[model samples]
Target: MAGLITILIDGITYASWLFIVALGLTLVFGVLKILNIAHGSFYALGAYAAASFVGWAASMKWAPGLSLVAMLLAAVAVAALVAPLTERGLLRFFYGRDEVLLVLVTYAMFLIMEDVTKLVWGANPYYVSEPYSLFGNVDVGKQSYVGYDFALVGLAAVVGSAVWWGLNRTRIGKIVTVVIHSSEIAASMGINVSRVYMGAFAVGIFLAAIGGAFTAPMISVQPGVSVGVIIVSFAVVIIGGLGSIEGAAVGALIVGLARSIAVHTAPVAELFSIYIVMAIVLMFRPEGLFQRIQARKI
Candidate 1:
């Protein structure tokens, strides 16, 4: 029973972070139809930004609780500054091109952003652990978990619910959906498809940054963090089916639990567990668990 409870708590915490990152990947793919390889770079940048901001806040003698706010603001700043620049400055030009070519473009962007990060932040690791203990701890069964962990679970739920509602229940969501179904038709119908693309891309970048910011306290913020997240997020998005919010949520849970189980039972299989699950899911359902077969128009 103790083991089971531990697994559940750890899995849910892991899933929360994965969902946040994968949600962005799915959102970008859903609306923009762009498989952004540089999304991971945005994540890394967010972590670095949060670490810097939170460190500054600490040095300024601000309240420790406000560090969370600083982290959120870091994500917003990244979304506001980087997303538009990337979209308008580069991705906009690549629109209507071959999908494969667009992907390569993003991969190139990822490489450039990596070097940019190194030039700016150098190679030193940043440890922003102040916020991790702000909320204190909670005792669940025999396991005492940090309150921040549970807070993250709540944050994930709120973010997921809000995105789902915005996409399904709001008017702007309807417009975005129309754009997603067929941007050409949307533009013909007098919709500013370019603006919609920019908005959606910004939102996607925001989510990625939020994931990285929130995760910064738990890990050392440094180079190479982006690579792991992009890989895992891709797995989650692929397993959930590209462009599917619910699929991203479900896929995160599945991968999280699978990894937790592997860690507790067979430590040797920890890294391979997620890929094995992805392979199995792909073998049975090529389009992913949530995405339907999109018909190719001749």
Candidate 2:
């Protein structure tokens, strides 16, 4: 039983990581309908940037706990600057176009950004140990693991709740939510959807950055690390229902736990576990597990 509990914890932590990376992707896709390949670039950039910042802090003898703030700041800084620029300068031209073209363009942008990473950071693996040391470890039954991993689960839950509240409670989040459901209606009502879209993209990018930053200290930060998660994350987003924040959280936990089981019982099944669920879900319930309910407007 202890072994099972340990595996479950491992799965949840992995799921949290998946949710953190995927939530932003779903938000952008929900709002823009672009299916951005550049989303992966942000993830990669975030990881690299976080690794760099944390490494610098450690070398300077700063507290490892402070690296968390630095990681978030780096992500926010990158998103604050890059989001508007990308939305206006490049992505704007492709608005309301074919999905395939938008995809090609974003992939081109992703390629360019990937090269930029190489140019800026070089092609080497960077790791941040501050986060690991800060939380230290815990003995879950017999196995010892990083407490930061559990902390990440809590953080992802908070982020998920905050995003849900943002969408339902805040004016800005409402506008963005409107944009997600119907941009035409939003614009017809003089909502200034263009700005909203930019802001949404910025938030999406910021989340991606934060995911990278958070994971950097726990995992190896390399140029291609973003590529590693992009596919699996898409699966999580799809399984959780597209453009659904709650769905993303739920989906991550599912995939994380499933993969954990596979890791222990059937190693070969780990890679395909998510896809199996994706196929099953898409085949039956196209809208996903949680369908929005709206009352009649009499």
Cα displacement (Å) at residue 46, model 2: 0.6
Give the runs in model 1 whose Cα sits over 4 Å from its true position.
none
Pairs in clash, predicted candidate 1: none
lDDT by residue (tens digit), candidate 2, 59-134: 8888767888888888987898789789999998889898899999988988899899999999988878767777
Model 1, 204-255: lDDT tens per residue?
A: 9999999999999989998889999999899999999999999999999999
- lDDT on C-alpha atoms for all candidate structures: 0.94, 0.84
Model 2 TM-score, 2 decimals: 0.93
Backbone collision count in every prediction?
Answer: 0, 0
Top model by TM-score, which number? 1
Q: Where is model 2 poorest over a 10-residue stretch in terms of lDDT?
A: 289-298
